[model samples]
Target: MTDEDRYELLGEIGRGAGGVIYRARDRDLGRDVAFKLLRREGSTLDARVRFVAEAQIPAQLEHPNIIPIHDVGRTRDGSLFYVMKLVQGQTLKEHLNGRTSRSELLFAMLQVARGIAFAHHRGVIHRDLKPSNVMIGLFGEVLILDWGLARPTRGLSTARDEHGGTMTLDGDVLGSLGYMAPEQARGEVHRQGPPTDVHAFGGVLYELLTGRPPRHSRTLGELIPRLNELPEPAPGPLGALASRCLAPEPGARPQSGEELLALLERVT
Candidate 1:
């Protein structure tokens, strides 16, 4: 059978600026999978380059906590698509809707840190690290999702689009505001590194403890100055770690996810 007939699209499970994810059945494997298809309308060459990177990057990261890409191809109409394991669970953002135990939340966050640590070790930096980008599976599995904004620390920083134009320029602002690091907020892409993701992990931890993001501003202008102005977290080891992770200066925070994971392991 042709690539078009190999998977039958069932329904859309998620949609983003670059692509749409559908619940599809792999005819050959007879299993349900997530089929992420690059959107056609308004899909610029840069967006297409990023979409391909999003799939290719994670496909190389073979970790239990990172979603696995089974196959990637284009439809008969020429829209790019990739198949991945269909997770049966809510996003960490949705899971946080109910009052979760502090221990349970920390455990989940620890798992996220582990996954991120592995990615960092592999030289991949997940520029966007937020609760919504995390998945909590039905059996207590935590998987990191969305590698579109991820950059490599050890390789060429920029990607080439179809027209040979640079896909991601240094000054292009990316990532969510509330969880974004100071350098990231300033669009200083050159300064983003493991510490960037560490800063976001701290934001995630702060939200878990307080049910709110570290920053409350509605605009980048209002948020940039106040990025360092986080209220006191609850008193304890975890709280102390959160404060350190959210430190305004990158040097003040954990250098990498591995360091953050080590620190978190000490919290009782």
Candidate 2:
């Protein structure tokens, strides 16, 4: 059988800044799958390390909402590739392109919070938790994808706080600009724990309600002050919870992802 015929490569599914994803099928297993192929230009040592780390992260996690990594290996040309369950759906970012109802928003965020809580309990922090990273399937499944920037800080840390996890080595900002925590924007080398993930969740909730980012500013210098001193949106339970979750100080935010989920349930 031809390589393509041996294992069917159906078509391209998605593309990201780091790699391209494809829909495939396992000929032996008789099941559909997805493959993530890293860009050739970014297949350097650091990139390969990051890719392997991501592949292993999900293997360590056994949660319904978190996407599980199925396999990983290097291509003959030295390119890196990984496989995962093929989830057929658009991202939360895509779902929010137009008007979104409150119940719909709450339903989506609930799945995200549950998944993140599972990761947090396992001592894994998803440094990148944005709408684009959340996939909502047609079969009523929400899968949290991408862990290239996850930080595992259970009992390991250093003065610089590099806990040997799949972290960004270049000190490049981890989270997306609008969803990043205040301390993260400062380039602080602190060990990202559960609280960091909570902050990003809050940002997601804010955008879900208002159809805009929680902290909006042109530059980092401008964003810090806005995040610190910005007034609460309005008189609503979800709005109040959003403010608390997006608190400038991580200490002022929810202690864990589970706590945030509880609060969302109460507010919703």
Candidate 3:
């Protein structure tokens, strides 16, 4: 068989800002896999750096809730790509196409928190955690999918973080604007830490409860002001939890993913 024939691309299953995913079969392994490739050929330095960086993060992480990457390499045509398990269900965004009850929302957020906790313990931070980055299995498994925006938190960021994960050097930002933490939005990359992810996690929880991002704002200019004085969320304890997570100051927020998850349990 030809080198290009190793994987039989079935069809395009999903597409996003990062890349396009295809449902394919590993002919030699006799199994199905989700193969992802950048939408462009990654010819530029930024694209090439991201192509390798994204694959390395997931490959290094080992968690039940994190998607496992099987292989990463260049295609016969020299385009970069990676292979991962094909989750049967849809993203948290798609799963929430209809209204969700408080209990169900809390349950999913708990799983998301737990996954982030696992990553945090390992010194990795998911700089971009959102509903679209989460995958729910047919049997109710929650898997954190993309690690493209993840990075080590022990030191000041370097060129890669600035270009790939952090706000761009020129003031452009990263991640979903509606879910971005204030520090991320302000381009204060040095201030990001575990709480940064916690802030995004809170934003996710807010969306889970209210069906929109915190304050329903979709742009950085709109989100930053509201971050300092977020409108009160739903009528009870979960509302309090959301507020704590979205605290404008990183230090004021829940210190870790585990701390946030614990608070969620106590409140709910």
**Which candidate wins on TM-score?**
1
Report the lDDT of model 3 for residue 13.
92
Model 1: worst 10 consecutive residues (lDDT sum): 156-165
Local error of candidate 3 at residue 75 (angstroms)? 1.0
Q: Which model is ahead, 1 or 3, in terms of TM-score?
A: 1
lDDT, candidates in the order shown: 0.84, 0.77, 0.78
Candidate 3 lDDT, 110-138, residue by residue in tens: 78888889888878888888888898888
RMSD of 2: 3.6
lDDT: the better of candidates 1 and 3:
1
Query: Of the candidates shown, which would achieve the greatest lDDT relative to the real structure?
Result: 1
Q: Tell me, what's the RMSD of every candidate?
A: 2.1, 3.6, 3.3
Ranking by TM-score: 1, 3, 2
Q: Which stretches of candidate 3 lie over 4 Å from their true place?
A: 1-4, 39-42, 99-101, 154-172
lDDT of 2 by residue, 31-50 (tens): 99998888667466556666
- Candidate 2's C-alpha runs over 4 A off are 1-6, 39-42, 155-168, 217-227, 231-234
- Encode model 1's per-residue lDDT on 163-226: one tens digit a residue: 4645757325778888989988888877889999999999898888778888877788888778
Error of 3 at 151 (Å): 1.4
